[model samples]
Target: MARLIATAEDFAFGPAGKLVTVAEELAARGHALTFAGSGTALQLAERADCWDEVVACPTDAPEFEELVGSRMAAADLLVSCVDRPSVELARKHGLPVAWLDPLTWWWGDEAPVWLPDLELCVVQRSIGAGDAAGPYQELPANHVVVGPIVRTGPERRGDAGSGPLLVNFGGGEAADWYQPGRDTNYPYVIIDLLLTQIDLTGFSQVVVASGERIAAEARRRWPDAPVSFECLGHRDFVERLSSAQAFLTVPGLEAPLEGWAAGVPTLFLPPSNSSQYVQLDEFRRRGVGDLSVHLRDFLPPLDLLSAPLRDRSERFIEQLRDFERTPTIRTEVAARLSDLLTHPEGWMPAVRRGHAYLDELGRDGLERCVAAICALVEREGESA
Candidate 1:
């Protein structure tokens, strides 16, 4: 029974998705585990409620190293999802570590130095192909490239029934662009536009999941619109998703990947952050969604994305502001929603295409990661 510490970058829910899945599998295998995160990742981590201790390790905390270093000294192994600092700390303590990366195409020069023997790199593809958005570094013998890493993974739904429409306005914060006050800023940009143009009364039992601020706004706007607004934990969100007739959300990698894994029909709302914009582009390039609507059409200069991370992120924010301010874009979003609501089953054909894309890449990432981590842990223990 090795002691394990797992963590994910707090930028979005996607990294936490990978963290919790790996931690859950390791815990079920009789290993003691701790989960560390902040922001959306922390929120999702607490929802799992399976950890021996869940420490809130904010990256900017003055005692961040001390907080993480203490855990490293105690743990037998470190498992990280797109979090480099934790891996570095574990290596500093001379421990075995496994790194999970879902955005291999985006990190470029920011990735950590590979430890040939003691670390295992599980690099996952963002989409089918054409993800060479930035420079990619090759890995050593300890690395394996795989597809999406999802939880409670069961491919092919058993007849998606007339379940409620799952409308997700996922985590609202990213680096400098998003903060506490920014909750109702976007996706809501489209939602506000949506409510004005289409009456959701046509759809029954609409469940909109997001932070409290967003939920409150939805409730206030459509007091009698027959919608149930909620702030679901990671596990509860998945429970809701499993039965969803169709899904519409920000184009972050995790949620759609979760839907795709379940064979749930999905449509992407516009992205809120740079990573999501890139993800949206890849989803469109692959033609894998409920009639893919590429945001790039509105924001020309796809070359802006190839710029440095900070520059590109700023560019996305500017363009999103323009998108919100534009009358045509508001109408475009509303029209898309109205058309989809008219034909509810229209998302499935594109979802089948999504499944075919996954089938092309293979979805054994979770199993492969678990096997590698287990092997790494056991080998390290034997060596000690």
Candidate 2:
């Protein structure tokens, strides 16, 4: 009944993946949705069956404002995830906007100069244990606080025993703020350790996923590991994790949350960015992420949380010394993986505990936000 324009930040798959979940829900509710995204985010949205139109949201494209403004003309509401430019477009076109931010734990408390006034509803997600002890705090006003915005995960199979153990090295498609090389140095080292140090015979099969460049590197680096590296869009990736008996990956909010939502026994590797560092620590602090590892656990010199927010992973990529070469790091990682892989039934209790913990934090943020977006249009149109 309502026309919706949506977009997500191309920083990582996190925002785009979450947008897909919300968009799919809105589409199921019979709303027409148009999504604008660039790079892999656009590719990801294209894979979803929810969008009526999936246009490229390149800020530098020709007549960008005019093109986007034309699209905005037919929309009743703008839905976005952590993307400022789309919000600016909505404001300029006098459209109602609902801004979804899933990173309340990692973002600064102050709203930007161009933000706030543009938002009809700021769906600020606050998910953590009791404390907001991180460097960032929640914004003070016009907020709808709730939990993580994750789907029910893959359609969950009856035969999970046969599912392969999944290892996600996280993704590499970010804005140009990150330097070249795909941020593969740290995760590549982790994969190298898995190939050389950790034994994978416990699971029937292990599928590794990462960026194209990293997948290429994985093949080049370990040609004989009996493992093929691949990259998956959000839908395929979640479907894989949802059915997995055991999942091992980085502690980024979305992936691990999906694993937890699917009740898969998960082991988190080190953090790729600063926010990931805080998220892993928070999960551990909450006692739900004890099994998860951290960068500090392996590389002591890399104190990512202490550094500035915007400066991420470049030095880690540059000075990435012989990480798997470290005997202690190898030993620690091997032990952690082995512990997760062994007597796998024992791991589910922790996984279930994590599920309960997340539920207690709140899971209805996406539903509530979608309802708000629909209300902004459906009710107003009815009154008219």
Candidate 3:
């Protein structure tokens, strides 16, 4: 059995989705999966028999190289989400690594140099396939295009929201600048906008999910809103989201996927970060969610999202259902990894060349990639 370590470094608002899905897949295939994550992931994983060993790797801790090195020595592969340090340590110990979520390159430029030595780099889309090379380097090789990996189903028990505008900012694991900054430890902007955006006189309640600190601020901010507002966790939150009529939120990738998955119509309050603002634009282009360009765009005496809103919500729901049925990155990565591991010389160069082209031209470039993968598979088929 292959032994693998999947890292949950991106431990904010269901960051472990990728890790959990991949780890579960690998386990079912007779691989032993060990997990390294913050306390949250460990807490969540405790309910399921997902990981062989759940090591607590806090983000605040000092040099974790020794601890990681020790754990990696027993593994053959490592799959990770936004955890470069752990990936680097795994490679140093001669274990193959697959880095997930290439879209997050916004974190650091130094990622590529640390990334290249891995046996494979799995990306979310054909568009994300490329070198982590320097500011002006041509691409390197051995990247594979795989769709995003998501946990198969919701873990937080219960259905979604019943409120007219069911607003949730998710957990405090990660937050954007518009989200009252990560250090503030609350879902302020999300809560503020949801409560203030629309009239609640006829609406049942305006719900917000926040830590105690943020909840206190929300109560202080809107004393006369004439709506019910409170902070809640897993079960209640999921139930709230599932039943919600309209969702008001700041644009974050995961929650929108969840809202869409649950067939909820959501309005995105403009985000503070310019990159995210543009990304939300791209999401609109890709039919991901509904987004507002400006704050006033979603503001006071808020207009209901009309008929177009229902159509888009249903489209997003359909897409999300298809996405759930679609094969995950692990299945694609596993197939690619297994092939590359068995025939490095022949397959590696083809993957490299394919990735270089895809990175430059995006998925529109994938006609060439598909031909290449087909040709490789054909050649292997003939040989077999």
Q: After superposition, how far is residue 340 of candidate 2 from its true place, in Å?
A: 3.1
lDDT of 2 by residue, 8-70 (tens): 887656777778888888999999999887865675687788988878757545565766788
What tens digits encode model 1's per-residue C-alpha lDDT throughout 12-92?
577887778778888888999888767777877888866899889675566767787887888888888877677766776
Return the candidate ranking by lDDT, descending: 1, 2, 3
Root-mean-square deviation per candidate: 2.9, 3.3, 16.5
Tell me the whole-model lDDT of each prediction, alpha carbons only.
0.73, 0.70, 0.47
User: Which scores better on lDDT, 2 or 3?
Assistant: 2
Candidate 1 accuracy as TM-score:
0.89
**Better candidate number, 1 or 3, judged by TM-score:** 1
Q: TM-score: which candidate is best?
A: 1
Colliding residue pairs in candidate 1: none
Model 1 weakest 10-residue run by lDDT: 128-137
Alpha carbon lDDT at 380, candidate 1:
84
Q: Return the clash pairs for model 2, or none.
A: none
